[model samples]
Target: MKFLIAFLAVVAVALAGPIDERGAQIVKYTNDHQGISGYNVEVETSNGIRTIEQAELRNLGNDNAAIVVRGSYSYTGDDGQVYTVNYIADENGFQPEAAHLPRA
Candidate 1:
């Protein structure tokens, strides 16, 4: 049992790969008055880092553009289990804390 536990621990650590303590966070500055309206953006926020996956361009209204962001973050929670956090661009702005705002 001891050997098995040790092996499993090593395997888990190896699979985790460096353990990204700092996750990803993305912020989008969208202009809804442009040719694109439905802009899709991907963002991931976890641990202490932020990652931007992909940003899509779309047109929802006349000469308007909205930024749509999507992404995922991986981190080890307090329970010692790997957890993934899914995030999206709520609104379009460069505010310091605009990412947490509610989306329309």
Candidate 2:
């Protein structure tokens, strides 16, 4: 009875942690192939703030991967523009497009 209780406790503890399969794959690819696989950031300043809500890495096979980031930013200024951007990074480099990117 005591052994059974201890085993159940250990199993419950193990199940309490979140599992991230995609993140594990990204780490594996990064370490094995020296590839850029993921990104996450959030920053705030007096004038502006930005947050990266989701960033993921997709394996394209052949040791290649693609990084996709979804984020939003706001500026506390006269324009007071707020918008979201989706970015992709791969062999071609980073490509980011924003629906409300400020134009000069």
Say which candidate scores most in lDDT. Answer: 2
**Best-performing candidate as measured by TM-score:** 2
Clashing pairs in 2: none
Cα-based lDDT for every prediction = 0.51, 0.54
lDDT of 1 at 100: 33
Using Cα atoms with residue i matched to residue i, what is each candidate's TM-score against the true structure? 0.35, 0.37
- Please give, for residues 4-85, the per-residue lDDT of candidate 2 as tens digits: 9999999999977545334422111111223465555655543244444446677755577666555554434345445556
Question: What is the lDDT for 18 in model 1?
Answer: 62
- Runs in model 2 with CA error above 4 Å? 1-37, 60-64, 80-104
lDDT of residue 51 for candidate 2: 43
Regions of candidate 1 where Cα sits further than 4 Å from its true position: 1-52, 60-62, 90-104
Query: Could you give the C-alpha RMSD of every candidate to the true structure, in order shown?
Result: 9.8, 16.6
